[model samples]
Target: MNVLEFLDSPELTPGTFEGDTWEPWRAVLSGAFGLPMDKGRARLFKRLSGGRKAPTSRVRELLVLAGRRSAKSNTSAAVAVYLATIGAEMDGLLDKLKPGERGVVGLIAVDRAQAKVLFRYIEGIFDASPVLSKLVSKRGAESIDLNNRVSLEVHTNSFKAVRGRTMIAALLDEACFYADENSASPDVELYRAIVPSLATTGGLLIAISSPWARKGLMYQKWKKHYGKNSDVLVVQGGTQDFNPTIDPRVIKEALEDDPEGARSEWLGQFREDISDFMRRDVVEQAARVEPLELPPCADTRYFGFADPAGGGKDEFTMAIGHRDGERVVVDVVRGRRGTPAQIVEEYAALFKDYRVSRITSDRFAGSWPADEFKKHGITCDQSAKPKSQLYVDSLARFNSGQVEIPPEDKLITQFCNLERRTARGGRDSVDHPSGGHDDRANAVAGLLAEAATRPANIIFECLDDGYEPEWHPYQMFS
Candidate 1:
C-alpha cells in the first residue's frame, strides 16, 4: 500500500513501533515506486524517508530544489498535507518547531496573487485523494490549519509581515523574489526572523524555486549551506529527470527556441530568461572600461538627468550623463516619498556634479516635479511616456552591445533581477515585478534616457599633451 494506507494504522505510531515514529514512514515511502514516477526519483524518496528517526538533528529544515514543471507544486502540497495529518494530525508538528515554541507557519511568495497558487495546489489534495477527502471537509480551511488548530498562513513579499510573526516554520516559494530594502531578497532578514520562531520547537523552513538572479537569499543559502549540512534534505533535479507529465517533444522545442531560458529553468541555474525578456545582455556586452570614477563616460559632454517621483513614493529615479561617440555614461541619484521641492534640491546637487545641459524628467507623476525644479534654477522637460516603454527602447543599446557597467554588486544585482513577461499584442517587455525592488532599474532608465540624445560638442580641461600616463595594473590582475 502507499503512504496513505500506512498512515491509517494506529499500531505504527509511537510507543507501539518499538522505534522512533519516523521509522514507520519509510515502509510507506518505499511504495511510491509502484506508480509511474522516475526510478531515480523513487530511489531518492526511499533514501530520504528511510528510518526517519527524529528527523535530522541540524537539518530540521528541508528544501526541495527542482526545475520548472518538476512536480514541485504536487510535492510541496503533499508534504504540507502529510505534516498536517501525520502522527496525531499535526499535533507533533509543534513538538519540533523552530525556536522550540508553538508558532505560526508562514507561506510567503511574490505577492497575494502569487501566493494563492500554492494554496490552490494544497487545496487540490482534499479533492484528488478519496481517503483524504473523507477526513477533510468538502471546503478545506482557507489557511493551512492543522488538525489541532495550529496553521500555516501566507503573506506577500512584505518584510514587515515577516518581521513580527512567531513562525514555527516557513515555506518560501520563489524565495529569490522576497522583499529587501529595494529588492525582494530577504534571505538575511527572513532567516533572522524565522530563527527565533523555530528555536524552541525545531521548525523546518523550506525554500523552493526555479533559480533566477544570482546573489539573492536563495542563491546565497544554496551556495553556503547545501552539502555542509547533513541533516537537511535537498532534492535537486532537472527537466530530464521528470516523468510522463512533460512531453519530450515539447522540451526539445522549448530548448531549441530559447537556449538561455532552458538553462535557467531546466538546469536550475540563476540567470536571465532572454527569450521573453528583451535581452539586456545586448546592452551588457557593449560596456567599456573607462578611467573616471562616478559615471564612466564615452567623453565629456555632460547633460542633466531628472527622475520625477509622484511626491507620494510612486517612483524615485534620475541619471545625469555625458556622451562620447555612441558612449553613454551616467551618474544616478534617487529618493522616495519626497515633496516636489525636496526633489528639486536633490537634482540641483546632481546638475553640478554631472555638469549637464539637458534633463529628462520621467513625467508619470507629471508637471509638479519638473515645475518644482524650475523654481530651484534647474530646468527639465517632461518625458511623457510609460517607464516600461522607455526601459525597452533604451535596451536597444544593451541588445546592440553598447554600454559600460561597473563591478558594483547592487548595480549588477538589480540588472539581473529584471524579468520578462508576455505583454499585450503578443509582445514581450522587461520589468521588475512588485515583489522585487526596482531602484537599480530606475538608475538604468536614467542612464538610458541620457543616452537617447547625444551631445554635439565635447570639452575637457587641459592636462597635458606630452606627459605620458602611468601604465599600471592591479596586484590581483598582475
Candidate 2:
C-alpha cells in the first residue's frame, strides 16, 4: 500500500482522519507521483501547479518546500519508512547487496535533536503496526534493524557520516538549516556526498525544508529545477496550503512582528533580509588551495588582531598576518574557547612568539580586554569602527584580488555566508546569517585592514648633523 493509504488505515491512525484531514497531502503527493486524483483534488492540483502539468510519469526525486508546522517532518518520515518497506519489494533494491551487505534507509536532520524527532516518529509508526513490526530484528538509539537485512539509520547532517552507505532512500529534514555548529556549508557538502551513492542504487532522495535564505543548494535547486518536467519534482506551498490545522493567530502574530521572517517561515518564501555579501566564486578564486603556516621571520614585521568572544558560546579567535610590500599575506589563524584569563594567557604566548608589539581587538567585555592584556605587558588597541566596517573594508581587498586568504574551510565558509543587508534608510551592514559565526572572518578583516591602511613605521634620523644644506630656488629646481 502507498504511504497515504497506510497512514489512514485502521492499524495505523484508525479513525483520526475523517473528512479532509489528509486531502491536501493526498492531492500534492498524487500530483507529484503522477497518480490519479479525485475531481476536487485534481482542481486543487491544477491551482497549485508550477511550471508544468502533473505528468503520468514516475518521479525519481522530490523537493518539498513548505512553511513551519506544515506536516513536512511527519510526511517525510512516512515517505522514508514507505520507501524502506513497501519500495523494497521492487527489483534491484536488495538484489545488489552482497552476502554480508545490508541496504540502508537514511534520515538526516540539521542537528542531533532534530534527527531524533524524526527517528521517534519512524519508530512509533513501526511499533504501532503489527505487520511492519514483524520485520524488526534490532533497535538502537539512532538505528533500526529489520529481519529482511535492511537498516534504518538516523544522523545529523554531515558528509563524512553519510559516505560509503548503500542507501535505498534518504530523507533530509529541514535541509535549509542543515549547517552544523562548526560548519558553514553543510547543505552543499552533504548533498554532493550522498548523490553518488544514490546513483548505484537509484534510490530516492527527498529534501524537505522551510524556505530560508536565497542561497544554498535548496534555493539553487528550486531556482533551476522547480516546475521543470523532469525526474526531479520541486513542490512549494505555505503553511495553510499544506497544514490548515495550524492556528491562524500564530501566523498572524509572526507576520505582525517580522514580515520578512514570517513570509519565509510561514508563507514559504525565501527571505529578503538574507543575501551574500561576497560571492562564493570570488572568495574561492582568491584563496590558496592549501594554507601556509609560517614561523616568525626576523625580517618581516608581523601584526595581530583578535575578535574576542566571551569564551562561552562563541569562539575566541585571532588572526596573524604581515604586509608583503603592497599586499597583505595572512600567515595563521587560530580560535579557542575558554575562560577569559585562560584565553588571554594563550594569546600572550602566541604574541611573544611572533614578536608582536601591539594587538588590536574589538571592544569585547568593555575595558576587560585592555586590562587583561596589560597583565602580559601587551598594549590592546580597541578598533575605532564596528565589525561591519571591517568587513566592508575587507570586501574591497577581496574584490581587487589584493589579499590572498588561507585555505581554511571555516574561514571560507564564513566569508561565503556573510550577508550585506540594506536597511530602509539606505544604510548597509555586513554580517553572518542566523546561527552562523564570523569570528575568523572578522579577525582576518581587522588584520588586513590595518595592513592596507597603516603606513610603515620608519624612524627618521640625521647622519650629517654637523652640516646644513643651503636652500635656493635655482638649486631646488636643478
Candidate 3:
C-alpha cells in the first residue's frame, strides 16, 4: 500500500471509528503489525497505531493509560512510524501547499537518549521491512526523515525545544515518568504553552505512557481530563490487556518473583516507593499526656480540614486547626468514608463548636459532599495543586520551623505515614504511605494552604505552658 494511501485513506469501517477517518500511512502500519485492514483493527489501531491524527487522522489528543510491559512501547513505535510516513508522504493534514510546507514532527521522551530509543525503534522497523524500509531516506538515533516533506525527530522531555519547533503532530511517551520530572517543571509549562500551535492551527497531541506516581501535570490532567473532556481519549490496558510477549502464567510468576516490581510495572502503582517524608516522629517526640488545663483567654482561629476522594478506596479525611501567627496547628477530626451528609454534619459541628474560621478540603470526586458544605454555608474548594505538592508545601514550612505541630496533634500521625510513589517517565507522588493515613495527609494540606493565604489573627494566651501529649490514634479517627 502506498504511504500516501495510508495517509489519506477514506475507507472507514462503519462502526469502528467515531472521531476521525483513517490516515493511509497508518493503514500501512497496521498491515505491518499483521493487523487486518478492517474495522476490527479500528479500536486497536486507534489504541495502538495512529499518532495525533492529521487531516485524515482519527484522534486529536491521545491519552493512553496502559499497564506496564503491555507492549505500550511497541505499539507506540508503530504509531511513530505511521506519523513519519505521513509526514514524508504529504503536507501532514496541513494545506496542500505544493509540498514541503509542513514543518517537522516531534517525538519527545524524558531525555535525548530516550527519545532516540523511540526514533530508533521506528528506524529499525522500517529498515527491517521491505515496504516500510523504502520510506526510510535517512535514519539515525535522534532522527528519521522520510522522502522530504516529513521528519521524525527525537527529543528529551524539554518543552523549550519542543515549543521552538513547529510540527504537524507531537507524541509524549512515558507520560507518568515525565510528569514526575515535571515538578515545578518548565517542560510542563511548555506543554501548556504549545497546545495552541495545534488547537489554533489544527495539529495533534499524543500522550502515551504507563502511570508513574500520582502527582504533577500529567497525573493532574489524567485525573481530570479522562472522564470530563470530550476531546481527550484515555486508553488503558493492564499487563494482560496490552502486553504481547508476557504470558499470563509467567506474569503471575513474575509478580510472585518480585512483589514490588509486580505492583509498579504491571499494576502501574507507586506504593513501594513511598514513605519517610513527614515529621511524625518529631510530632510524636513533642507529644505528652498533659491534664485538661484551663482555657486561654485570647481568641483563636481554628479550621476543620477535610480531604475528599473520587471513590475507589480513597479516604475522606478531616482536620480541625487553630492558627498561631505563622503556624496553624491542627488535630485530626475524622477520616473515613460515609455519605456527604454524614461528613458535612460532623465537620460542621466541629467547625462551629471549635469556632474554626473556615473548613477546607481537596476538590476531587466528592461532588455531593462539597456541595453539602456549600449548602451549609461552609467554605470549601479543591486544593490548587496535587496532594504531593500540598505535602511539599506543608513540609517546606514545617522544616523551616515556620509551622508548628505539637506531638499530641492527631493529624501528625497521618502525616508520618505519607509516601512518595514512583511514576513512569521519572515522576513521583506523595500520598499516604500504602496502608497508611491519606486522610491525615490531606487534612494537613488543607490547613497549610489556608494558613499561607489571608487568615484571622490569634490572641495567643498560652493556655498550656506545659502540654499534655496523650493522643490515642485509633479512637481519634472516630
lDDT of 3 at 117: 70
Tens-place lDDT digits, model 2, residues 32-129: 56778777887776655564577675577788888998888878877777777776655348876778988888989887788889998888788778
Candidate 2 ranges with C-alpha deviation above 4 Å:
13-19, 90-92, 180-185, 288-291, 424-426, 457-478
Tens-digit lDDT track of model 3 for 1-478: 4433443334411222223333322442443323345664555544432332211334456666666665555546656666556533443354532354545667778655667677666665665566656656776657776764566777766666666455667778776565221122333665775675455335567777766555545666666655342455454445655544557786688678866657656765443454357555454543334421212223544555677654455556676655556555554345666665776777666555555435666756456656777766576666667667887777777666655543434355556555666554467667753223456557767777767774445333323421211223332110
TM-score of 2: 0.89
Using lDDT, give the best candidate's number: 2
Q: 1 or 3, which is superior by TM-score? A: 1
Q: Model-by-model lDDT, in order?
A: 0.54, 0.78, 0.55
TM-score of every candidate relative to the true structure = 0.54, 0.89, 0.47
Instruction: Write the residue-wise lDDT of candidate 1 on 1-478 in tens digits.
Output: 3334333434322122233232212322333212233455345454433322222223555554456776555445555555445522333555554453335667776667777787887666655555554544334334655444355566666556666555555777766556554332456576677777656555567677776665556666666545443455444445545333567777677778766567667756566432223443443454445432365343344665566655453456665555545656554445455665775677676665544534677655577766676675566777756666767776666665555554344554456556665433456666765355555466567667766755433444422431112222421110
Which portions of model 3 show Cα errors greater than 4 Å? 1-57, 87-102, 129-141, 179-183, 199-201, 225-229, 253-261, 268-478
Model 2 gets an lDDT of 0.78
Sort by lDDT, best first.
Answer: 2, 3, 1
